[model samples]
Target chain A: MSDAAGDPRVMLRCERLSVRRGRREVVHDVSAELRAGEIIALLGPNGAGKSTLLDALAGALPAAQGRIERRGRVAVALQSPDLARRTVLANVVLALAWWGVPRGNRAPRAREALRAIGAEHLAARPAATLSGGERRRVHLARAIAVRPDILLLDEPFAGLDAEVRASLLEDALSALRSATRATLVVVHDRAEAWALADRLLILIDGRLVATGPPRELLEQPPSLEVAHFLGFDGRLDDGLEVVLTRPAHVALDPAGPVHGRVTRAIPLEDGVRLELELEHGRLYTVAPLPAPGPGDDVRVRLEGGVRFPRFEASAPVPSTAP
Target chain B: MRLIWDELGKALPMIFHGNPQLLDVIWFTVQVAVVATAAATLIGLPIGLALALGRFRGRNLLRALANASLALPPVLVGVFLFILFSPAAPLGFLHLIWTRRVVFIAQTILALPFVVALSAAAIQALAPGLLAQARLLGAGRLQVSMLALREARIGVIAALIAALGTSLAEVAAVALLGGNIYGYDQTLASATLYEVGGGYYADAVAIGIVLIVLILILMCGLGVLQQQGNGIRMRFRSAA
Candidate 1:
């Protein structure tokens, strides 16, 4: 996963970046770098300042106290897909023109970008008449047409259905792969981060808490908050060891050491979800169906779990910008 | 009632056959209106966009000033310009009084507030992120403004139409500034006022009828253009 990030080319570097919205400092003391040909996924809960960080990095918002060095141009596909009332091709071409592409090259570059995202058929259509999915594709094309050195996408797959999201994710990632030197994308779904991102930067409460490969961080989350966000339902402390429990890591086995009584057995499309009452606390894990009923005894074997130390969340530092 | 019908009977032939004097007045009115409207559009669009999107101090004050100017009395505007262009005044050195240029200036002044206010309103109604998105796409200040104007074009067209209407219907300002000269600068609206004051009821009615017909034809033409734009947008909307 670090193969792309290990490249020696640095596209953008920011040091101690702090951003303010009105009087509140939304992004605080963030230092990171985007190397060429790497995809870094920004993950956080709602109101965790993901979009604010992206805006500051894109130079759309003024940094309250930091310096950002960029090697070349940056382009962004914003969350709302703010398109002008023009033809789809014209919208992409307009972006190219703004990036200083020559008039002779704008149309062909725009069309090629649209084709990359499977939106070539919509070139002649008016932007105002596009559907939600079509608008997203056009916006991606607009961002990709310029071949920017750094690309920022703010929830590009938000408000999309599963089928459309899957299809667009595939097409958009492939299109973006060839267009930018480095990419920073904000994503909510962990699977999306795993699928597209070579590395993940987890932000919690306006502070960058962890940065590593998705699987590496998932295996050993340094803090309790990261574990909880990564689908660890609860901690199992049985007086001997403290272990975090996630649904995918627990299984039912008669010879297993951990013991709990089933409180609720809820059937799911793939399996049955069982609520178990352990000696220390209650835990939730999905088990095979037709095995666990309410009040039934179960022994579950855990695999690939880690102990996370309890730590306090960092407080936002006061901005020192005059 | 009998006099009204007799005047209408006399005005009909003049209106139908295009009286030379009436034709000259119509042409002057049209030239002034079109030029004033075009000039107002050029100057008002950027100011209007700034008023909508700028976030500096005293923006609200400027917006309020633009809105309040809509109700300004045309005759008061005429009086102000008259004083400014008087022989003893500061601007009297140019000696532009009672000329077609003064008429053009007065009409533009009268129509400017409509364009600015309505254009600002149109821009404000757009999605807030449109401007920010343009910025994210690497547009400079001028290109961002151009994109904003393109996105809010419908509202801008309406603003132009409103400014044109305001200019076409102006009489007191044209009369005060141009002096309603007989053969040189008299518009249809000012000529109607002059005929009525001289008790030439037939001529006044004829000129008034011509003004209404001219306004109707021009408004209809502009209306068709506006509708064609809307229809093209709707055609794509429904086809999708």
Candidate 2:
């Protein structure tokens, strides 16, 4: 949403960054800008170079081509915290020490940071003794303790339970909101990122396929690759493809064009989701109508339906190398 | 039982009443082993780290060479160093033959592979992704190294202790290079050999007992390091 690449608030910028593993390039020509208070969700499937790009941005991996500029310090909370055999307090303090914080100030500042993350009780505990959730919190504390200008997290909420995942996501976003730190997080779930990210970058096989505000891209993706990744399944029409809207966007209407026989119905807290057998294919849509039995005929109003007449996805995704 | 008691009885006076010759031999042995172990640790640590962390060609070859060195007979290493220090050899220009310096060289050679192989294995056992995470957290090269070394501290201590044990019990190398000269370059191991060859079996047995005691002390050190190492490993498992 914030395309302030040339503004003074830009914290980190990658100008056509390319990263290689051995002799083969894994990230190709990925240009993006992170500005103050901006949260960019980098979404891609497995092996899409999300980790490589995040590592390059954090300066952990070297760029094989192009450049990355940072206005100030950058910190990262990697997937594995890679904790040392030290107490939590000492671990966070070591991070500050690595950033050249003065010896007299290291412990105090680290303690304050741990407190801010609600981990003060874990200060004296060994880092290797913390649970996955606790370790992730400690990692976040360590990253923010240095007061970095740009923060990169590699699947920070990965492997967490649903409740822990939600809590950590909220805490991390709150931390970014409180500071001017620009954060780039690599996530696999597109729907969650769509709702949360101010801006989004969709990568497929190390190539940038789309970048825009998450809401904007959700409503209209520039490429079919992005649309599929965002859970927008489609019927291959001749010149125009019909997109199936999500369950929450579908409604029951007697005068609608699409008709189907319900095969399965699931009740949501606010509405009901139905698995309808349409003439073209099966569609999973939601409606506020009374619970429809398995054999009931239903007419669905497609409130969020979209048509793509300009982009044809008959060929494989092209590599954006040059 | 009688003979064993006689041997211990006959050697006790020499030990308790302060035999300067025996003490000098023991002190010389300890000095050589200590200096050799120190030198081996200082030089082999970096080599071990390189072999463990460095990604390049011939790294496995280096590790293999180090492992092969461990199987090399002490007598062969002794002969190799003896010939290198001989008058006809190029290194003979230093004229370091048949001196305690030569004994130090032999003892260091005998102990070096232990330090390298064990320390490298210890470093390799570090938790994965530690280096990348450290760099991401903004650690410099030295800081990253320090952090990894700290994680592997117990293994490194065990390596040093194992190397010390090897150096302390060495007799063939020191005898070949230093010539077992009494009150000069002679060590506890060499003196034991000297007493055994000279028919003083009781004195030899006494020195042999002392060497066993030294090994026991090292075993105690290894036990302590193991306990500490296990504590950290358990903590790591719990976190996982």
By lDDT, the best candidate is: 1
Candidate 1 runs further than 4 Å off: A1-8, A178-180, A253-268, A288-299, A309-322, B1-6, B182-184, B231-240
Give the DockQ-based CAPRI class for model 2: acceptable
Tens digits of per-residue lDDT for model 1, B147-218: 666667677778888889888888999899899998899988889889999999999999988888888988
Complex DockQ per candidate? 0.47, 0.42
- Tell me the whole-model lDDT of each prediction, alpha carbons only: 0.83, 0.78
User: Which candidate should be chosen as best, given DockQ against the real structure?
Assistant: 1
Residue-wise C-alpha lDDT for candidate 2, range A66-122, written one tens digit per residue: 888887778888887677777899888888878888889989999988877778899
TM-score of each: 0.90, 0.87
In candidate 1, the residue pairs with backbone N, CA or C atoms under 3 Å apart (3 or more residues apart, or in different chains) clash, namely none
Kindly list the per-residue Cα lDDT of model 1 for residues A1-322, writing each as its tens digit: 0122233577777778899888999999998888888899999999999999998888878899977777777888889987877789988888887788888998999999999999999999988899888999998888888888888999888898988889999997788774337999999888788888888999888889888989888876767678788887856763434566677777778988778899988998878898888887667888765667999998877764665332332221111111
Every candidate's TM-score, chain A alone: 0.89, 0.84
Docking class of 1: acceptable
